[model samples]
Target: MANSPSSKKRARQAERRTEVNKARRSRIRTFLRKVEEAITGGDQAAAAEALKSAQPEVMRGVTKGVLHKNTASRKISRLSSRVKAMGA
Candidate 1:
């Protein structure tokens, strides 16, 4: 219960931020899933393209504070490696 007016305002702000962050996280997951589906489906070109599109969305998540920088980098690295391996 937020008794103070300022605290109530903060609570409202937090609720809004939580919804926004949740949507951002879901969007990032969707992008990652697209890449994974492409990779698993054995479409190298589609996988490469999906990875290309996902990289920016993942980085955007990091920039927006929904994901850590290292986490985003690691994900990008692993996906790119898998995409590359598909070519070989």
Candidate 2:
């Protein structure tokens, strides 16, 4: 469908971006999952450490445009709260 030269170039760029973004999203999810598993496992110390490590990864996802700022904030907030509650 992209007949023009610029359109073709754009299509190619989009394809590459999609691949990169997919990997970024997967990486972020992996970090989040680790935090979740630690929390659910009732290991307060491990959950706290996991969340501490994942926090920057989530923020990096925001900076790299893989995640929205507000979305990352909400996730971090909720995860921290759950981790905190685990201590109580």
Q: Put down candidate 2 lDDT per residue, 34-59, tens digits, no spaces.
A: 99999989999999999999999999
- For model 1, how does the per-residue alpha-carbon lDDT over 4-85 read when each residue is reduced to its tens digit? 9999999999999999999999999999999999999999999999999999999999989999999999999999999999
Task: Write down the lDDT of every candidate, Cα atoms only.
Answer: 0.97, 0.97
Estimate the TM-score of every prediction. 0.98, 0.98
Residues forming the 10-long window of minimal summed lDDT in candidate 1: 47-56
Worst 10 contiguous positions by lDDT, candidate 2: 23-32
